[model samples]
Target: MKNVKARYLFLAATGIAMVACREPATGKEHPPSHHAASITPAKAHNVALYQFAGTPPAMAALIQKGIMTKLKVAVQLMQGQPLPAMSFYKPRNRYIADSLLVYLRGQRPAACEKIIGLTTRDISTRKGEIENWGVLGLGSCPGTACVISSFRGGKGKVSESIFNRRMITLALHELGHTYGLPHCPDPVCLMIDAKGKMNLDEGESYCAKCKNKLLAQGVVTK
Candidate 1:
């Protein structure tokens, strides 16, 4: 009798441990997992590109091409839109990236699965203790909207080609965030965090691990 009781208790404890391992606590900022994806109905992935007034048409086309080829997602180029004056931060002389995302989300067309706003204006978002912290771009994890800016890429008199490449890098990074990918540890991965340093030149492509994660989520093709 004593041996049976001990065995039962051990089994119960083991089962509890397994259950705990299977279900992590969910939160607003939690990255989506395969378990979450399983419950949601699968849908085709499509991206929409929006060129804000003042951004060059050539630059937007470059970014659109990158998304289409690398991400394997259909993209639609929307009509040019004016930048919202309310998003401008006079003190920083930059636009608020968070506000731009909200605007993009609201403006997102029904046919598009995700929307990205492109601009040449400097953009900023709150980071930790700093208000109006400048960033190359910003996006919501596992969300439908993102925004990128080329103002920082043109700095330091970089060659136009290099500057354009940086913009493409920024666009890819922000879009990766929208696909629920966090900063990758691989130094050369496109998803690597800028960490306020703007080292776009270092990123070549998504690391294998990051790409596999996207593959599992069906965001990237094999």
Candidate 2:
């Protein structure tokens, strides 16, 4: 009787341990390694950028550099009019990308025509002629166009290792949506959704197939 009782107790302990170690059904319990593709980059007339006053200067600079670099490359590939100059604005408070657009329409109607607001809000809109892109800091978008926000530490906290590899890729990805590009099938491409948790190094600058698509859309020429 003692041996049988001991065996039963051991089995019960093993069952408890298994249950404790089991993975969560909801997936949010663990960090995600991959993100789906949300949007693609094409071409546009002008892209107006809005940043909150609290945003670090370094982050603003990174956004400008990454966006311009990609735009330049897209221009080289396509024959659309050169991207209009990008400008920055200071808002009263952190605004959602869509809300910013509406506010700009009331405040600066002319400026709003070319404006694109960047925020950390979790956005669910698709990319198109009139749609704006949002990129939340370190988050993913279920659909095209996300609201991207910065990490809490400020620009200084974003190291080159983080910016070049992660932030820049995200900028390019969101910008792609503005130009009417859809998510890419390639998991490692910058156009991939990445669910906002991708390692920057895992993205591609531009794939040939994507390039061709841009050309077809009149976003690129050659």
Candidate 3:
């Protein structure tokens, strides 16, 4: 058996991007989902963020605006939807990340380039080549959907200020994948894997290398 690289994770109080599975960061091309549907946008930068019913609304609003301004994208804070029970993991009392992806795929807005669901529930994926428990989030590239959970950021352990930073960092990290970016080797870059040690650091913006790639791909102008 091939040795799987173990990603380090912080002890978050509650919660969780990327596909349910990840290939090694050796820059190999993984096949795209042939039936994956593209999301249309009201404008080039339009991004739709769906807040699942149980998530904290106030925090979600703040995240919506932050994403809009920071990434130079137009983020729409849509009405909350009840998380589907079909995604529930009875043992962990968490939802399955892929189920949310499947849900978001069907819920894309006509004027949005990507659709992301925000929830407070813990989420996980059981399909990685190696066992993965309690993931921070998951996203698929060239797909219109992704999701993030604030449940695991270790409630009350993180100061309001730092909590916000971590949320935005992971938000952009997963969103970057939706724009077809891979996990960056730079520890301080937003594209670093959330489970990486770098996330425990204070930086929240994309590194220059990633910023230029986004510009080149037309995912972001600024």
Candidate 4:
């Protein structure tokens, strides 16, 4: 795999706006049923969080809390299953993020309005000409499921505050996609596209326009 830092700088310098927290179609140009019929604005209340095996408990709790507080939704920690072996790309030693979304949606309960998968292992998806592009997270746009990983965010030298912020920012960003929010042009918005860079610190929260959109969708009360 290409070095993460180098790829980030390359994309940032090129000003290439790669999809952030977006999953390619579950099938050929069509999302899966769960994605297609995800919870509506008013129904987006309960969320199921799957802590995939090997993910840290503290991290999972933090994610759950972050989502609950930021999105103003109920988050329940469900039983975590093993990451699908089929999603693993042996050569890169990472899980296919799109496949992981499929797995996560399948595991969602009927009662939960949405679902998220958390893991420590690396996850990736295709980006432009490059196949198996590593990503911090991937969420189905206007769909029900998403996945995030700590492998990339926790790498290198970072303070605990920065690391925690990165994790929380990723969770909120992916969930924002599921709530039908697109990548925001505002640099400080939580929904800003990463554009193939590790600039989580640049995002503080949802911008006013994005927050108003979420408010209209009933995803967040405040």
Candidate 5:
């Protein structure tokens, strides 16, 4: 009798332990029907270009206006949507490209799909590359977009009218670079070389080949 009682007690204890192990902690079980659908990847990106100081106020405004106007037109042409808001940042010192990138990361906006930095230095140029030794604006981590910088200066003292015209072309060019575009072969296109020219002549838009390229990238429509 004593042996049977001990055996019964051991069996009961094992059963209790097994039950406890199998049961999940309260509130830990996931809902059976609440699995969320994966978020669709973004096809187009909205970029915010931050301008650091050292650029003249008038020049900055011209750059901003030109970029905004061309970007709007580009979106319309592409049949794509624009970000609800685009912004600029002013830092006390020049070359705040890194700081601006850090700032955008902290904001954590879903709408701000990308961030681009516009500086007076050529990011692709060797000199600017050396200067940006410790910078992080070249690109973001995987699933994030890249950052592109452009240099737009030559003459020491350009007239206001000329600067304004130059701003229009430069803005379009830089924005094009941001959108994964390269310089066009066509001399008349806005994305053509700007070694000495200041602006694009009226009625000159993206060249046929460039337009086809943009269309392929879903950046422009027929």
Candidate 6:
């Protein structure tokens, strides 16, 4: 268990999915390479954690602690809110991570650098253009918001610590997107393509190159 600094690792679909999307894992999403990694420090960022209707209080508390301890940024626990009565849910009953992201951005709090919506319900996003994939989460480059689902992580018979690590990994990966970090070339980095919820368990928080990118983008301190 290395304290990965971050790249995304693709899943091989080898084992039983505790909660998985329908999309196949592809390991080719990252950029070619960054010859000169930026070390120019940007100003500090403010991250807001929002709890959806079904988020478990105990789990949310642990995630908040992990964000503050690991990322070292200003982490604020915002007031709990409910999803608007809309079509964010698909036929499979999983919520749409992209739809939630749109809502969060349109109504983002003032001065919030980035915001992550955590929920107990399962979430998914688009795979190609119209097809849906049962993703653990999703976000955008230099975007204002992202969403993560704990229901997928809590599906299996795992310990509390492993579950917490999964949430933290998902959090940092989406946060990386907000800093404009693409997937990393490092096979074992946190920035690698996340295929399934279990895909996150295999990589370090960040690989050397991805860590540099996070540093360059000011997501991680040098």
Flag regions of model 4 displaced more than 4 Å: 1-44
The Cα RMSD of model 6 versus the native structure comes to: 13.5
Q: Per-residue CA lDDT of candidate 6, range 1-222, in tens?
A: 111101112222332111111222376574655743564334555778888776778777777877766574777787667875563675888776767777776655665677888887777765555456787777756566777887777656788778889888888888766666677767788878764437778774777776775666555666
lDDT of 3: 0.69
lDDT of candidates 1 onward, in order: 0.75, 0.41, 0.69, 0.78, 0.41, 0.67
lDDT of 6 at 125: 63
| Tens-digit per-residue lDDT, 34-126, candidate 2 | 552353333343444555444455655666667666554311111112111222223322333443333422332221112233433233222
Highest-scoring model, lDDT? 4
Residue 146 lDDT (model 4): 84
Pitting candidate 2 against candidate 4, the one with the higher TM-score is 4
TM-scores for all predictions: 0.78, 0.48, 0.76, 0.79, 0.46, 0.75
Off by over 4 Å in 3: 1-43, 127-132, 196-202
In angstroms, how far off is 49's CA in candidate 4? Answer: 1.0
- Cα RMSDs, all models: 14.0, 21.3, 11.2, 9.9, 21.1, 13.5
Question: After best superposition, candidate 5 residue 131: deviation in angstroms?
Answer: 11
Note the clash tally of each candidate. 0, 23, 13, 0, 0, 15
Residue-level lDDT of model 5, residues 1-222, one tens digit each, is 223212211113221111001222467776655444564333543444444433444555555566555453211111112211222222312333333334434432344444444445332211223533322123322112233333444335676565466545655554554444555667778767544344444323667776665566454567
Selected candidate, larger TM-score, 1 vs 6: 1
Error of 2 at 208 (Å): 2.0
Output the better candidate (5/6) by lDDT: 6
Write down the lDDT that model 5 would get.
0.41
Q: Highest TM-score: which candidate?
A: 4
Model 6 CA deviation exceeding 4 Å by range: 1-42
- Using lDDT as the yardstick, the better of models 3 and 4 is 4
lDDT of 3 by residue, 1-222 (tens): 112111112212221221232222678765786654573322456678898897787878878877876676778888767999898888778898877888887887766777888988888865456343676677765456778888776669878877777777777877776766667788777777655243634457778887886776555666
By TM-score, rank the candidates, best first.
Answer: 4, 1, 3, 6, 2, 5
